[model samples]
Target: MDALEARVHRQLERMRELADRMAAVRVRETSADGVVTAVVDGNGALVDLELSDGVAELSPTDFEQTLVSTAASAARRAFAERGALVTGFNEEAAEDG
Candidate 1:
């Protein structure tokens, strides 16, 4: 293969690896009061939701807020993790190039 073709192939392979790694990432977050927990994937999709006994004592509005905030936190964390992975890949590619 030509040098340019080989370089393109290598970059495609690296991108595939990055996609796989990102898909495998999950971030878990809990509310400050420990009443709510949420899990989100690298794409910021909710994967799981959990509540503790303390949640039962919260008012309806508080409970709703807790769930929203907890899930938001988890989603943020997941995206941050995704960003880190992309950053690492870019740094490595830059160094290699």
Candidate 2:
């Protein structure tokens, strides 16, 4: 391959690796009182949730709020992680270029 073609090939490989890493991303967050736990995937979709018996003490509104907040926190963390991965990939690609 020509030099430019070789560079393109390398970048394609890096992109594939980045996609794999992003796909594997997962983040978990729990409420302060341990009543609620949430897990989110790279796309910030809630993949799992856990509730402790302590949740029984919460009113329906409170429980709903806590569950939403916990899931939001986990999704935010997942987004940050995915951003960092992309940033690192970009930095490496820049260096290569």
Candidate 3:
């Protein structure tokens, strides 16, 4: 292949790799008491949630706060991970070009 075509192919491959990496990204966080766990994908969408038996012992307000805080933590982690991955990819791509 020509040099230009090879470069284009490499760029396309890098883009595909980035997409795969982002798709595989997930962040999980549990509450301090370990009563609630939240899982979020790279897009910050809640993919799973777990509630331990101990959660039932919490007051209504505490239960709500735990769930909300846990989910927010997970989402924040996912966003941070996604940002780092994208930033690294961009740096690599810039170096390559």
- In model 3, pairs of residues that clash are none
Worst 10 residues of 2 by lDDT: 1-10
Evaluated with TM-score, which candidate comes out highest? 3
lDDT of 3 at 19: 94
TM-score of each: 0.87, 0.93, 0.95
* Per-residue lDDT over 1-97 for candidate 2, one digit per residue giving the tens place of the 0 to 100 score: 5999989999999999999999999999999999999999999999998999999899999999999999999998999999999999999988997
Error of 1 at 22 (Å): 0.9
RMSD of each: 1.5, 1.1, 1.1
Rate residue 74 of model 1 by lDDT: 86
lDDT of each: 0.92, 0.95, 0.93
* lDDT for each residue of candidate 3 in 2-96, tens digit (9 for 90 to 100): 99899899989989999999999999999999999999999989999999999879999999999999999999999999899899989998998
In candidate 1 the C-alpha lDDT for residue 34 amounts to 93
Deviating ranges (above 4 Å) for candidate 2: none
Task: Give candidate 2's TM-score.
Answer: 0.93
